[model samples]
Target: MIKTENVSMRFGGLTAVSDLNIQISKNEIVGLIGPNGAGKTTAFNTITGVYKPTEGKVIFKGEDVTGAKPHKITERGIARTFQNIRLWKDMDVLENVLVACHLRMNVGVFAATLHLPGYRAKEKKSREFAMSLLDSVGLADLAHEPATSLPYGKQRRLEIVRALATEPSLLLLDEPAAGMNPQESLELMEFIGKIRDQYDLTILLIEHHMQVVMGVCSRMYVLDYGVTIAHGTPDEIRRNPKVIEAYLGVD
Candidate 1:
């Protein structure tokens, strides 16, 4: 569903990702794994339009979406969550999702001001859809609670729900297990598979947790510095000489 050809991202003197090619298919979960400074997040950022690629092309479905604005990418059925949580801390969980759905809401400001029938109807439907999303993510009871009041795991799930509110065909999750405990990470890995099955989504995830990647991903790529060292099934990656060298310095 997504492909990148010779994609590269350079910052002044340093090339973070160099001549990388990646392809992800529909309803498949792919993991992007690497050591620190390996440029996994850099690639994710470039693909999501958080940063424009210095060279090459990014295509979603069949069209080249290279260098498109983030919102434009989101509108085209790609949504993402960051390595760090980006939520409306002051807002309720439902409100955070409502904010995401606002992107697709077709209500005019004037019509909303006067509560026109169409505007009200759209708002009600969006609310119902958002509630269903919240319930799906196991955040229904927390719908009225402030985002800051939720536990870290739920906060992470909320981020997923907000991204789902965009109605994405593909999801780019950057380090979803970064700060979680071992159990939390395991649960999240399982949850990733469950959510993908439930939503029938294609996910490209960047995760530092080895177990998380190997457990949930059907395939993975190992990056070193700015290049891909290996790309294969989890077992293949685990036995790869280059990947081992990159991660453990050829011990």
Candidate 2:
């Protein structure tokens, strides 16, 4: 559903991403893998409108969305979770997701402040939808609990749930398994697959955990020093010499 053509991002003399091209089909889970400083996140930022690529184009669903604002990108059906857990510490689980759901609500601030009938109706629907999302992710019981109060893994899942609240067709996850234990990582793999089918989403994932990427992604692109080194299936990537050297230096 999204593809980049020769997309590159430069900061003065530094080039964070160079000639990166990726194509992901609808409902596919694709992985972007690389070691530290690989510009994986930079690629994401460019795609999500955080930064306009200095060169090339970002096309989504047949539309050229280069340099579109992040909110505009969300409005066009793209949502993302950051590499770090970014829960609203003061908001409860339900409130956290409710914030994102507000994006789809079509009500004037004045009407919402006065609690007009139309505003109330939309608000009720938002609450119900938000609760249903929480329920689906098994977080309904803790809907009223502070977002930051949850355990680390649950917090990560909650972040994803919040992203889903935006009702996006494409979900970009940045290091969803960052701090998880092996068991949690394994569960995350299953969770990733579950959500892909459950939400009918096309996912672009940036993950350092090799197992998580290989286990869930049908195709992957490897990067080293902001340049793509290999692109292939998990098995093929595993056997590629360039990928091996990128991760484990050659003598």
Q: Judging by lDDT against the true structure, name the best candidate.
A: 2
Q: Give lDDT tens digits, candidate 1, residues 148-214.
A: 7999898999998999999999999999998999999999989889989989899999988887789
| Best-fitting candidate, scored by TM-score | 2
Model 2: per-residue lDDT, tens digit, 1-251? 99999999999999999999999999999999999999999999999999999999999999999999999999999999999888999899999999999899978889999999999999999999999989988999999999999999999999999999999999999999998888999999899899999999999999988877899999999999899999999999999999999898998
35 in model 2: Cα distance from truth in Å?
Answer: 0.4
Q: Kindly report which residue stretches of model 2 are placed more than 4 angstroms away from their true locations once superposed.
A: none
| TM-score of each predicted structure versus truth | 0.98, 0.99
lDDT of 1 at 97: 96
| Model 1 RMSD in angstroms | 1.0
- Worst window of 10 by summed lDDT in candidate 1: 242-251
Task: Rate residue 201 of model 2 by lDDT.
Answer: 99
Model 1 segments beyond 4 Å from truth? Answer: none
lDDT at position 40, candidate 2: 99
